[model samples]
Target: MENEMRSANTEPLHKPLGSSRTFPHFEGLLFSPVQLVKKSLADDVPVDIETKIGPHARRPLKLSMPIMISAMGYGVALSKSFSIALARGTAMAGTAFNTGQGPVLKEHRDNAKFMVVQYHGAFWRPTVHQLGQADMIEIRLGQGANAGAGTVVKVTDLPPDVLADFLATTHEMVDKPLKELVVPPGIPEIRTQSDLRQLIHHLRLAGHGVPIAVKLAASNYLETEMEMALRAGADVIVIDGAQAGTHGSPAILVDDFGLPTLAALCRADDYLRLNRRRDHVSLVVSGRIRTPGDMLKALALGADAVYIASAALFATAHKQVLKPLPFEPPTQIAWVNGTHASDFSIDEGADSLARFLTSSSEELKSGIRALGKRSLREVDRSDLVAWDSEVARITGLPLV
Candidate 1:
């Protein structure tokens, strides 16, 4: 069906949704549960699932669970109401929400408990006040979906209010209104390791001692990139694998570029361990990490935490999607420029997403207890075995 649609058109087939391509993920890796060898924790026993990012920084970004809402920009990826609902939902879950490559909305700040703002390659950068309000700062080097590709937003497609907000925060002077806004492939200011270090340092000062994170697309050069980020004094490293989703991107980049989440995590873990910096820097992995089991597998494979986007979006809409069913796509109610976006209920979306996070967190605790572990940090590669020989070789786990 997708191929037919592609063949029908000459222009690149753009999905208004995430990448549909499947990648080798954690499905082959199974948890080695304890029973006779090691007594499992009783159902009544407590488990600690709390996570801290950038523990070595002046102030770490703390979460009640190891799950976070990945960057979904407002006014570009999601409607204002949807963005605020995400903020409220993450706050309810006692987790963190990230502001993607869009202008920061004050409503998000007001509702969010912990907000991580992305310093993107766009001309409209976050202001000092916005940076100061962030719980953490993520330097967007690249993402899983588009890799280093830039973004183009047609002015006519955006809501008037959103367009106004973007123009207001733009760093460059515009004598006339722009027909389209273009986000460059990479930060124009950063061309070398020294440039990155300076930017991180400046962001640290602007963020008022908040943890500084460097987000990168998973690639073959993962170690070299990690080294550069480490030298730049990054407190946290976020790896978004090829399996990650996006609002929209070229099919070529989505299907062919970047490494799979499983491979990226292993390589990143090995690099950090080899340099003895694993304990000093926090590592967060994201790319098709939907279920609690996937989250557990990622943590076991050496990720300190995981991020979720499509799952969170679906959870937010949940049954509300039925409202647009049989007539228009569900995204019509959630997208920033969605036709039915105004009809989206913020309260309901927030409640649904909060419940999803809470439920996922509880399931994680159950998995931990089944492994005879009481803490998330206790589950490591030792607790995992690969069902596939190739997976075992990649993860260095015993093949079952």
Candidate 2:
């Protein structure tokens, strides 16, 4: 009877629909290795992993590694300790940490050697004075997890200190009751192309030559989006694909929206090359880029750099994840207001995360040597081949 019931209750997970299983992602594509004839003499010599974002800027954002800590905000998604730890860890790795749609905190800024501040639809928009503090400013247009949607967090779930900080930074509490904090779908002020251009101009002046980046979810019309961003005077374009993670988002949106990371990268790269804007605007890709191989592949496909959030969070929670055990998700340890949030040690987190970054970067350099390349710029489409026909067609790469 138990076996019969179990059989009856079983459901199709990979393909719940008639033919489609949500949207396709990076699982279908892979990097084809070349190990026969051409090989690097610098296998023993150190490879140059250093990267620059927004090369056209008077001063570009330089990173020791091509991988950067992606946005996971304080109060909104992560605890203050976790945020600071992430910042310090990336600083140790000589990369940047992004403040994801959260209010900029002094603790994060102090710890982060390079900071990417996200100007989101949330009420906590940074003031002109605060904008000047950022190494890079990202105008978040949409996210992979919830492409055209917004999120709401209740004030009741917030701690007193966090609530106080939020109130101090934003105008929501002054205008409305603190029952719930709402983030609108898009920046209400940015309605048209002219508005976008004007906002970018103002942000450029406020940031004092810091790179102004535009972050967008990977969509079918991504080429148009890239053109629009460039026209609006964006220095960098960040694309987060469907496989990207978020603290909380509707299941439908997460599963059904946006293009896969690989498709987005190839399409965007092709568009940039065609228009001769590839060098003028920096391209940064993210979403499910967990391994060093994925990072290297992205760079080869035309991404100047890659962003990592979920992987870094997992690295930070290396040992502490066990504290939650079978009862709760490991993420609870780093989550704000989580039961195990207090158990997360900032020192341990930073150390583990920095170590992970170092090891991953080493692995990337080794891969570059295998490809017979001295630097990242030398590693391009010729260094890569597709595993299957679909991938080959989409990427315009030779099939293995």
Candidate 3:
């Protein structure tokens, strides 16, 4: 069906949702539980699921659990109501919410406990005051779904409020409103390592010492990119793998580019360790990480935390998807341009998402206790074993 659609259209097939392709994930990896030799933590024993990103930074991003809500932009991706729900939900769960490649929505900042603002390659730049409000600043060079692809949103398509915000934040005054807003593939100011270093320095100063993160698509040149980002003084590095979700990315880019999450995480972990920089900079990995087990496995393999978008979106919508069921797709309730977007209930969505995060965190704590560990920091590669030989080879874990 997808191939038929591609054949019919001259333009690249634009998938309105995430990638349909399946990548090798953490399913082949199993956690090693303790029983006889090493005793598991008692049921009553408290487990600390707290996580700190960019620990060495003056203002590290601290969360109650090792899960964060990944970037799902307002206007471009999610509706205003959905974005605010995500903010409230993350706050309720005691985690952080990221303002994606869209205009900074004041409501998101107002409701979120911790806000990570993306410094993206878009026409509109956040004001200095907006930067100061961030818990972390993520420089989005590329993402797993689209890599360096640019986005073009027709001005007429944007909601009135979103359009106003965009015009207000634009760097220069336009005699007339732009016909469209184009977000470039790369930051115009950053052409070299030195340029990146300077930008990070400037952001650090502007953000009043908050962590400066560099988010990159997990690629074959992962190590080289990591080196450049580290040299630029990035306090945290986010490796978004091939399985990462996107609102609207071309089918070819979604299916044919980037490394899988498990491979990317292992390679990144090894690079950081070998260079003795693991302790200095935090590592956050995201891509098809849905369940608590996946999150735990990511942490064991050396990710400081995990980010979730698809999962969070589903959780937020919960049974409310019935509103757009049968006739319309479920995402129509949450997407910015969706037919039923205005019908989305912010309070209900927030509650549902918060419950999901809390439940997932509890499950992670249970897994930690089963491993005879009381804290997330105690989890390591040794706590995991691979069922597949290929998985074993990639993760350096023994095969059962």
Q: How does candidate 3 fare on TM-score?
A: 0.98
lDDT of 1 by residue, 22-92 (tens): 66679888998788999889888999999999998888999999999999998778999999999999999
Cα lDDT over the full model 1: 0.91
Q: Supply candidate 1's per-residue lDDT for 192.
A: 96
The lowest-lDDT stretch of 10 consecutive residues in candidate 2 is 11-20
Expressed as tens digits, the lDDT of each residue in 286-364 for candidate 2 is: 9888899889889989999999988998999999999998899788898888889999999999999999999999999
Those runs of model 1 whose alpha carbons end farther than 4 Å from true positions after fitting are 3-10
- Candidate that beats the other on TM-score, 2 or 3, i.e. the better one: 3
Per-residue lDDT of model 3, residues 1-400, tens digit only? 9899989988888775457776667999998878997989887899998889989889899899999999898877888999999999999999998999888878988899999999987768677889999999999988898877777777787778778877778776678758888888868879999999999999999899999999999999999999999999999999999988898888888888899999999999999999999899999999999999999999999999999999999999998899998899999999887888989999999999999999999999899999998999999998999998889888888999
Which regions in candidate 2 have their CA more than 4 angstroms from the true location? 1-36, 171-176
**Cα shift from native, residue 333, model 1 (Å):** 1.5
Question: Where does candidate 3 clash, by residue pair?
Answer: none
The alpha-carbon lDDT assigned to residue 276 of candidate 1 equals 97
